[model samples]
Target: MNSAKSPAKKSWLQTLIKNKNERKKVIFIFTISFLLVVAGLIYIPIYKHSLPLDSKIYEGNFKELGSIARIGFFAALAIYPIFLLLKWKPLSHIKKGNFELKPLIQFLAKYVRQWHVPIALISTAMIILHGYMALIKGFQANFTYFSGIITMAVLACLLVMGVKRYKRTDKKWHLKFAISFLVLFMIHATFS
Candidate 1:
């Protein structure tokens, strides 16, 4: 009788309320990263225009790259939330310790894990592309360049550590590195 009601009688909201700490952490990480990305998009152009005319990176014709950078920025900005939503389903399961390594769950984890790195890479790439354009057509390469470099490093670390986490069947390093990278990248993006 108890086994039968176990799945049906439990409410999702109740479960969240019970594990508020983890849920809060998840929300915090997502919110901070989202804000940073959005903020970066807004400030990048202003920073670029602040560059001196003689800077090698900021002096080139960048109309096309600028347009592409805009597209890339918006695309990256939009896709991140969707990716988070998709992973949220499984994340809830994992948090509940209900993650059975069955074929379906395994398959979902595989695809979702694969999806994350490329999205992050593309997002970082777009940021870099934007920075490159700014370097050539604007004066302030210091902030843009430093931000781009840090973003790339964070993404790369996330990817490498991510692969290890997935294959090792451990979530410890995954959470540590993933959260660290996200936080650091957000800071770099927003501060630069």
Candidate 2:
């Protein structure tokens, strides 16, 4: 029953998900997400009071936790460097026509696989803490909290999917979830 001109059954999204270049694009998307989160935190005043005499981040014991969260944010942002190094070695290997990726890629991939769960958990916690700080400051506006909340949720889902994929030993689905999460996070960051 097959015809020479039989049409492709897969949708465009399927095609996109299967694209080879999507791997590196996914990494860059996360890099941009990291930058956006960092930038937003920098420019936005974290604590706003809905009521008089409320605790401000600068003037209270909250400062310590805030500092810790800030440190975590910076660390999370810094992790992108590992991604860059991973990409560099593989890209160079590929460019030289070596079908075999550098051994470093395996090392990097192992770290990327093993670390994602804990990283996502800590990152989710930090985002919550940051949101709490934001709340103490009265930033309940639709755009701020809603977008931030959505972004965190998307990231959490992505992390869970990623971890599941890793356990199932499926690289394709892992990258798909990761890329979708990155895209959602970026949109969320932009709105926030």
Best by TM-score: 2
Query: Each model's TM-score, in the order given?
Result: 0.36, 0.44
Tens-place lDDT per residue, model 1, 1-192, is 455544456565445334455445445544655675567566655775575545555434343443444444444344345555555555435443654434454565555543443444445444555555555554555865676566567656655665464356545665566566556556654565
Model 1: residues with Cα > 4 Å off, grouped in runs: 1-114, 135-144, 169-171
- Model 2 vs. true fold: TM: 0.44
RMSD of 2: 13.5
For each candidate in the order shown, give its overall lDDT on alpha carbons.
0.52, 0.55
- Candidate 2 lDDT over 8-105, as tens digits, reads 79864445445445444554555655765666465445423333336453335334544454444444444455666666744554644546556656
Residue 171, model 1: Cα distance from true site in angstroms: 7.3
Which stretch of 10 consecutive residues in model 1 shows the poorest summed lDDT? 58-67
Pull out the clashing pairs in model 2.
Answer: 47-137, 48-137
Cα shift from native, residue 143, model 1 (Å): 4.5
Assess the local accuracy of residue 83 in candidate 1 as a C-alpha lDDT between 0 and 100.
50
